[model samples]
Target chain A: MDEVYLFVTKKILFNLVSRPVAWFDRHIVDGFMNLIARVIERSAYMIKGFQSGRIQQYGYVFVSGTIVLVIIFIYIW
Target chain B: MNILSLFVLIPVLTCIGIVFTKNMKQTRLVSAIGMSIQLILAGLLVYLYLAERQAGNMAEMLFTYDALWFPTLNIHYTVGVDGISVAMIALTGIVVFAGIFASWKMEFLSREFFISLILLATGVFGFFISLDLFTMFLFYEIAVIPMYLLIGIWGSGPKEYSAMKLTLMLMGGSALLMVGLLGIYFYSAPDGGQLTWNLLEISKINIPIEMQRFLFPFTFIGFGILGALFPFHTWSPDGHASAPTAVSMLHAGVLMKLGGYGAFRVAIFLMPEAAQEQAWIFLILTSISVVYGAFGAIWQKDLKYINAYSSVSHCGLVLFAVLMMNQTAFNGAIIQMISHGLMTALFFALIGMIYGRTHTRMINEMGGLMKVMPFLGVVYVIAGLASLGLPGLSGFVAEMTIFFGAYQHTDTFHRILTIMATTSIVVTAVYILRVVGILLLGPIKNDHFLHLDDAKWYERLSTITLVVAIAAIGIAPLWLSDMINVSLAPIVNKISMAGFEFTSLF
Candidate 1:
């Protein structure tokens, strides 16, 4: 009976702590990893498209100008 | 001395002048000149308003001009500017001027287009200035009527359907507004007292809470529909997508703001108790508009449709802020109105430039556009960044204030609603970056686009002006915020005095 009580107490403590940690690992960490992976993949695709000389045909002037404007705006703000 | 009258008269007479001119160049020249003059007057008015504020009398309306139009009904042709009206008037002036310049290249029915555009501007200016409800409604309809012709006649792809949908929906809203106005008139008239539609006079009388409750939704929803509240907002995207560039810019930039301004001025200011009770409903509907609109934009392939959806989402933020019923939130709402107007105008202008060159708007078909027209691409991205509320942009400041103000309210439900609305910022980022990446950053798939040139000088001018205006507001919002706060203080005080408690949850 003494051994069984000790075992039950350990089991309750383990469940209480591990469940929240497990849930956080699954939802927060995993979700962040997924988001980062998606962003990286998208960036890689864009870089690859840039390398193939495809970006040359479209209006890069506008894109570059927009980036500069955004940077300047951010600096000022 | 007659600056307000000249602002309205110049535009009205210009419309008349354009209609009579058989030559397109002559009509264009006249319209441009008229716009230039109006811009100057607007600048003068803003300067005077600032001067007045500096002198420590910010509460009094500037450029007070009154003429009796209907003595029998006690209605007067009253036009004046508080800080809010002046800011809106300045917005209209800038947009109208830029719109004229943007449409300079149009070859189709230029005379008629300029005339209608000028007429629309006249109505907008009138709406902003008019203190009388009857005149305000008349000008509201005037501003709306030209949109039908503008879109239906000069628009592309299902123009008729889009125009009809927009006109019918807006007219339906106006009908409700008319009912609300009539209700106020009849209810306010004493057994021996004369009926009046004068806004200043009517506001003096205490409207019954029950009657206000009944009329608030009618008037609020009536005007809210144009502000692009959910479900009733279906017309905006379709209308904007089909309308010409200048029309799109004006409609999104100024006309939609009229709806929000009217709702605040007429409904909430007059019926404070009703507004307090029913604000949560607006909060819920507008939050849905913000979130759902962002999702809607993600699925759209057309450039105009994307911007149109963004407008719906951004404007939803304004309504959300208003319903928070606090000074900070209300101030944010006004700022959002102005920010969205400038940002969306920039978007439409850039899209118009691209559409002019490519003769197409499909995202799939547009790739690596940044390679050729770098200036246009960069401006497009800047506008996109602002739209998504990237920190330091006008959208970010406005949205942050709104969220902060909303969270202060003790109501957990409202706080949650605000949280839901914030998701739109993320969603907006997704679609904006997706479009930027796919359409502007990727490999140019079409061989035909290799020779595409940058935006023309006129386009450059229009775009740069908008960029400066947006940056000014984003970077140093204090000047504009102070102005808006000054105007909002009385309204906030009234709401508070009506016994609405604002408990700070934070």
Candidate 2:
């Protein structure tokens, strides 16, 4: 009777819950985070050469210039 | 001057005043006073709008000031507020006020700091009240510009890189928005009227369904980027994590909401057919973000990063509710915006205070803070509880309404998505509890943090204001809900445009 109970308990613990939890931890959750991290890494890569990014440095100039053009267009249309 | 105009002008003038201040004290005092006055004005506007709403003119703009600014293009200097704009304007007022108090202790280049802060605020006020497209976009550009300097000059940990990353991503969004606005302008023409940039006039000119579908993504993605829509949301965590406390407060609190506002007011309203058709795409993406952000926060050690990711989740819910295309859900979306704004602001404000004292934000490094700084701990608990959608807190009502309303209006697929989004609350609860348990309630793990001081006077003022605002809105949601319901009626009723999306492109 004791041997039978021990075997049943082991099967329930391993199959019913523990394995799925382990699989989830290793695959689903980790996989999801890794995918997000890769996307973030790729995005971060786009700005790696920003030490000399002139357009970004003086974005205000372009923005203001656009504003002036829009105003001019509005006035002269 | 019209009341709507003053909300913009006063902040601009105050920003100018701060630029010339000699010391931190004078600078803070001036900005605080200015924001207080702006708050009073916002309160007055809400009162007037509510009074007008009660008088049975709920669907129309309460007060409209229109002048033909550019006769050539028919671009007018127009401003007004329906119930929705009034609520948003009032929210901006409260957040900006609390943000000023949160930054009271900053002494480095204090003058320039306040100047930039108020300038950003001026643009936010202008954007909400704008009844003309040119005015709205101008304010939008102005609002986004100051963020670069504010973050780069005064932020911490990867500030420069974060600043650059944030600016570029937002500008990319702006470019898309510009194209969409211009497309609308060129396409719009009332039955016999000449092309105009006046929102009221353009609403009468319905574009072809095909054109609306084509233009939908431009406006949706453009504004959705700022709203921290999934996949495009990477900048937000970096931005919030690197920003100074007050800037973070305003940025996450109110600035991000501009995305939802712009998307609904412009994209969905202009292209109702597209909204109803492609809502499934939005439902899937937004629900994924809602769950994804909560899970992301679970493993994060940084307090600000946790909040940042949480924001992506909550803000996703805002857009999710918008795509529901129903009255209650739409109302709930606006309520979520306001509630999340206040709650997130409070969270950041408290985080800043803790980081100041503990010199660390890692939950593992902070153990049993409740015994040391009871006030801060208590408030943090309040904000955290609110975040997890506890009843009698602001988030609870907002989210509950969204779930109920969305389930009511949508079919099987959307219903499944709604249920998926609902599970996010469980995730949120787990993470919030983990942080609260580790940081606020546990055995003291370090001696150095034993006697850390509680919140300062200014900090207390900020937290108290936010706490009261949260509780009041949660307990008695009727007043705010009434305003949102009225403004949402036309949109929910499928009245495309209805003169709400005010920006011109041609």
Which candidate's DockQ is highest? 2
lDDT of 2 by residue, B1-506 (tens): 77788988899889888887889999999999999999999999988887887777855576888888789877788998887788889889999999999999999999989999999998888889887877787888888999999999999999997898788788989999888887888777735557766665555557677878878888898999899987778789889999999999999999999998888888887777777678789878899778878777776779998999899999999999888777777778888999999999999999999999999988888899999999999999999999999998899989988887777843589788999999889879877988999999989888998878888899999999899989988999888888777677656545534322221110
Interface RMSD over true interface Cα atoms for each candidate: 17.9, 8.2
List, residue by residue over B435-500, the lDDT tens digit for candidate 1: 899989979989989988998887888888788888888899888888877777667767777787
The stretch of ten residues in a row with the least summed lDDT in candidate 2 chain B is: B497-506
The lDDT for every candidate, in the order shown, is 0.84, 0.84
Where does model 1 exceed 4 Å of error? Answer: A1-77, B20-22, B189-192, B502-506
For each candidate, give the TM-score of chain B. 0.97, 0.96
* DockQ of model 2, rounded to 2 decimals: 0.05
Q: Considering only N, C-alpha and C atoms within 3 Å, which residue pairs clash in candidate 2?
A: B133-B503, B182-B505
Supply candidate 2's per-residue lDDT for B147: 97
TM-score of chain B of 1: 0.97
